[model samples]
Target: MDETDQAIVRLLQADGRLGHREIAEIVGLSRSAAAGRINRLIESGQVIVRGVVHPAVLDRNSLAHVGLVVRGPAEPVAALIAAREDCPFVSLTSGPHAIVAELRTSSAHELDEALSGLRGLDGVQGVETLSYIEVLRDVVGPVGETDHRIDDVDAALLHVLQSDGRASYVDLAAHVRLTPAGVRRRVLRLLDAGVVRIGALVRQPGRDGQAAMGIGLRVSGDPRDLLEQLGALPQASFLARTLGRYDLILTLRAYDPAEMLHGLEQVRGLDGVTETVSWTHLRVVKETYAFEGLAP
Candidate 1:
């Protein structure tokens, strides 16, 4: 992707519903040219525009990261875990643990059940879980309150958006038997309430001259101050306060290994940080925010 493509991707990442003309104005291209480029990007599988449902929408509020120590080949185990709906983000890492997966569940009981299910999988020797206390930053926009109300019509609209975020208001109105104006109002309400986010999900983004790592920090002093400091870094993608072997967990992306090293060193030098552990993501097996069966 060239600079223009990258800029378009960034714009869509922020708002997937951006019109071709709007993007064209920002990227200094003709409207037709911008539309062509966006179409090409989607057709070539470089970018995907979809609505990411907030966990709060479905009452699936509990979030945790589970690292697994596989007895043998990690791919087979990783594949098995990747197939599970609850484990949305899964990867094979170069570190103490071979596989790491994120589990999204509704309650403590559900989380326990999911962990027990993972323990029963073959080649799973041990499991380490990190429960998120507060998510300072999330890739899918802010994690909003869980009390957002939605009816059957709203769920249907969300389901359609999940498949095609840029679906025209007229098209959406057809799905729910509402007028285009009413449909637009409903969609805007959902977006403004933070119940759903329409954005671009790039596949294998690290292939674009980038390196990513997961860092686990053990902090001694008040973590609030440290969280604010770390969360402000440009490289930080996902940041959270957690309970487990680490107090704070985050993911960083950089242009090269030296830059990654520099970012790591910067984190280490922070005042409250006591110890730090990090793992390089060898491969991301499954990273999805789409919640299936939206209608409830």
Candidate 2:
């Protein structure tokens, strides 16, 4: 995690399929050296490159944020929720809610069942849910419709990419029985249509004194202007309008406590903001964008 490593990560975050030579050109290193560093980073479990299927493709349109109040240890409850396929983001925080998780499902009924399952778990005292009305910003990439229909070959490619986003076109061709050129075309089509995004998922926050916080805001007037303002901030990672105790929710990542406070204060100064509540993430039990199954 030196400056060069950080630069390489930024490149991968933009496009995980970047070749070592390309990365080396930008980072000012030999191709083999760049490749060595990237391999070490992945081997160390610091960064994972994968294809993140859009919710539209999987029919996981129903998305919600659930905060749990546990009677006993929160780690066990968090671990239990993390094991569920639908829950992608889960963390233990320092706030009234001991654990917070995000659920993505195909329908509202499934969402209810998932919540009920959570409530039935031992040590679960209460559950607070925030259903997303509209996602303004996503951590993966721009949200788009499922313009390209997924056939068997496409499905195979997606599944492989989920495991290894930087899989060579020749390797992908062998998997799907298509020519390398054809495989490349199909992969590009998926990326262009936004059906899938190829990027790096940081398993842990950067070791450079970085910290993250979740902020819930209650806004008054037209939120459109406010959203535009908040969305432009560099620290704002995720943003959404939701149906719950809070009108808007977002996650901010900063280098230190003072920087986090500054970001929060900036949000408070926004015109339409009425009140705000926040919690520092004590531990991120799980944060993954990859899904298990892709329907054909």
lDDT tens per residue, model 2, 12-73:
87799999999999999999999999999898988888888888787889999999999988
After aligning candidate 2 to the native by TM-score, how far in Å is the CA of 93 from where it should be? 1.6
Q: Report lDDT per candidate.
A: 0.86, 0.85
lDDT of 1 by residue, 67-167 (tens): 99999899999999999988888989988899988999999899999999999999999999999888887765546465679899999999998878889
What are the root-mean-square deviations of the candidates from the true structure over C-alphas? Answer: 2.1, 2.1
Model 2, global lDDT: 0.85
> Residue 269 error for model 1, in Å?
3.1
State TM-scores per candidate. Answer: 0.91, 0.92
In model 2, which regions exceed 4 Å deviation?
Answer: 206-209, 255-259
Q: Which stretch of 10 consecutive residues in model 2 shows the poorest summed lDDT? A: 139-148
